[model samples]
Target: MSEAPLAARPPAQQDPLPAAWPDHLRALPALIEAAGLVSFDFFDTLFIRPLADAEDAFDILGESRGIADFRARRRAAQAGAFRVMQQEKRGEIDLDGIYRCFDGLPDAAAVRDAEYALEQEITLPNPEMIAVFRAALAQGKPVVVTSDMYLRAPWFTALMRRHGLPEVPLFISADRDCTKRDFGALFDLLSAETGVPKERILHIGDNAASDIGKARERGLVAFHYREPRLPPRCKGISPAASLARALIRNHQQEVPPGSLRELGFQKGGPAALGFLDWIAGAARRDGIEHILFVSRDGHILRRMAEQVRPEALPPSSYLLGSRVAFTLAAMTPANFESHLPFLLSGADGLSPAELLARIDVPAPGASVLRDLGLGPETRFRHDQPEPMRGLLKAWRWEILKIARRNRRGLLRHLLELGLRPGQRVALVDVGWNGTTQEAFVAALRGLMPLDVTGYYFCLADSEDARRRRALMPMESLVGPDSVSPGMLAAIHANRVAAEFFFSAPHDPVIGYRDDAGGVVAVEDPGRAPTDGIQAMARELEEGMLDFARHHTGWTRRLGLRADPLGLAMPLLEEMADGSWADHSGLRLVRNFDSWASSANHTMWLTDYAARP
Candidate 1:
């Protein structure tokens, strides 16, 4: 049977028109109240291509002969042909005939691939629309999606779960052996399943003919979404939602009562902050009173909030956004809620679970991983390699992935120079002349067994009271005052041997001066100290390469590895300070950027005993 004529329903007698909507668009909140199930388009309406620039595509996979030009033309043709196909489909044309018509287009295969790639590639959804979904669930409305494209159901369902959307039902034209314009089959199936009158339902979609016009042709109120750049096919459409939001704004209404306190609805944790901008906007529009943010990393939460409100976000908006606002006391699930209140009250320290619990709104104690049905190894799939001889293998993948040829060459230089195991070395890091003893101590701790020690002289304006104050915090909490440079110098002079000397990349080269005013040799007690330093430097150079090869895989996998050789090249150049004279036993391996670059702070060497 043909679909019931939506136009047959008698129109409601008009009530005195209130202030017309700003520019006649219905508010989103008002639209939801006026209807039951709202339909939406999936692709462009809900999700968007993350790469805005056309060149971004070519940049990702590298250049190919004629690839860029081919891609541009193919996209243009596919879009034009798709539009024609859409019109024909609305007139009930056969799908196979439509496909055959497009088969003759120039670069038809390329066009098809581009269209498929839109689905195959990763997509980021509009955060604002997701908030609308959550708001609908909060109102106890039944939600379903209808789509023209043959999208994988589980994938979209997982996408919904990932974005903090409640798990709900869905419908697709492909599943029903139908297409977008086949409203008769779709509406009949939905009406029978939901048992809601067709008039009570409202459809909102970006498509003009298939979605808005067809739904309007039936008895239901259909709205044209008019949102820019909506994808061709989608099911969950709600044009009324935007109008509803505006209505809520115009009425200055409180959010539907008990929305926040509703069952199975709580705060989100780490992932929640990922969508802060979306949540904050929805909360503001819905008049949400409080928002709670929970995360193991307070720093991340702070960053999220900073991004969302920047200048205006306070703690009491629709959501509570914080580091650990839930269960802070317990390590396990059994004791989680027991300690939740104390943690929220700041009486307990933050725990990891509490952090996650505060952010998640899933069924309470619901294993979010299991609820979404993701595999345990999903996160590690990209990093793990096939087993070799029954043991996990981590090949050196990181260094090889470096984009710049110069950077890779520099890394090679440093690897050739690093200190090997069982070798002694002396390392010195330069900072302010007399400011940070902490830096010296840290260097000593990190560069262990290498006889590494930082050297700095005392500040000129030293005082006893200040020196004592500095020492007091460490020993007696009331003992000495702040430390003075003179006190430090005195302590060092008495305890440290004069044979030891400080090295500085920026310092003037001082040693024994020859008759020509050129430096000859460093005079010391039997020259043993200088000889030892040189010996250590030599071993460091020889062992560098082997260590990098063995450890590259581990470092890259953990994101803790750096190409010391690569990072070192720039650093060595900086330390040279424009003096490029060849040293007998040492070569500039890498010159890492200084703190000024905010990238890495390292300068490396290839040989300590010989100059290259």
Candidate 2:
């Protein structure tokens, strides 16, 4: 019988230090200071073991005679035993107890040799991870290690300590025989030990069900540790990133800007009513006899106006208990302003003093210098003497005040044209949906009651038509094919008896055509609606209603369905007796146009230029 000799093995190659560590990661002290507590995980997440030998290696090697050769077999045996132990874990066997049981085995050296051999083959620290923990320590971040293992506390602690992570706090489920996945156990332990708010505690681990997901579900921000050997499905799909993004989205939702309720308007019906009250109060305070509220979309406003009961009326001109005397006239701002001078002139006769007398107003204050009448051009300099200067200043102020009053009176006279309570008024808008309609309705409802006895018809686009399909089933259902801008306008004029309309301006069915004869379509996805004025006005006129008053005259509130200024300029030009200038208020409100129409012309030119 012959004995075999041992072969010499080459020295192991050492890993080189990384050229440069990430500075951001290196500056973890600030983060640690910010974070009250830090936590970690163990096992495959923090440490990974190498490949194993056959299933029965350990038992086979246990029968080997010599220690040197047995060492190699022991390594193989250790891996086999670890595999068996892991498999036993699934079958309800305690891995730690198994390891301890092996500790008490008869061939202790063989087992020890097996463990050492396995350790040499498989065990190593993850370098980047080493950097992370070390950086955290430098930043004064307290470390806590949590694991869902069936290992003894002493053994786990000893294992981590051996792996350069001893300073970190260790919270092992098996240590207390309480798993981290058990929410009550983890919550109780975290609350009792850390005394930190549950929200402040961040649990980082690999398992979604047991670690990050459960922790996050309990209002804690969970940080899932990504490991390299993870399957592609698991990569970057941790609940941590999802939770963070969801939190941001939720925050954004909670603080959405420009909502009517957020703007101090009451929610629902009360908001509509309150808006009317606000508008009335503002009109009264401003002494504005004629208040024109032009909307590109006027559905809700028109509804409210039509629905006003007599009891909702404010009594005195601009003052009664619940009623206000201010007349509500809605047209495109351009049209309104064009006729503004005449309207103001008409309102010149509306005496603020008369209105004040109707309501109970306190007496005016007495003048200190009563009889000094000065000319309009009388001047006073800053360098004038005190007493005489004061008198001259007073006289000068009186003259200036009178001039200003007269100027305002002229403006009022011009603006007061056809301005009277109980006068025929209309609110024009661009679209049927959104806040503008809501706001206009509230304002109008405050003024006059509506007539619901009239017939109802809706001139809508494909989108709106689709939404209203259930209501208009038997009617000629026009899809994209039959619907056009002129067709929709005609529909509003002929079918709805709509006094006011609201619709999208860029909607091809209602949008304005420019000078070179091009319809304004939103071809550029990059562009946003600058303003909805003309569009709103056009929608109000075209999409909303066709009104036939007792006078046998048809009035349409046409929204320019363009930008406010864009819509305004064209209406102004049209008012000057040009080709588009046709202001017969009895038939149509105004033509809404756009400054941005040129962009459409440019696109047309570019198209022609690019032709083959």
Model 2, residue 419: distance off in Å is: 99
lDDT of 1: 0.33
Error at 20, model 1, angstroms: 17
Model 1 quality (TM-score): 0.28
Give the top-scoring candidate (lDDT).
2
Candidate 2: what lDDT? 0.34
Q: Would you list the C-alpha lDDT of every candidate in the order shown?
A: 0.33, 0.34
Residues 313-357, candidate 1: write the lDDT tens digits: 434211111112111101123333343332233212222222222
Model 1 off-target regions past 4 Å?
A: 1-26, 50-122, 150-152, 182-185, 228-612
Angstrom error of the Cα, residue 252, model 1: value is 22
Worst 10 residues of 1 by lDDT: 261-270
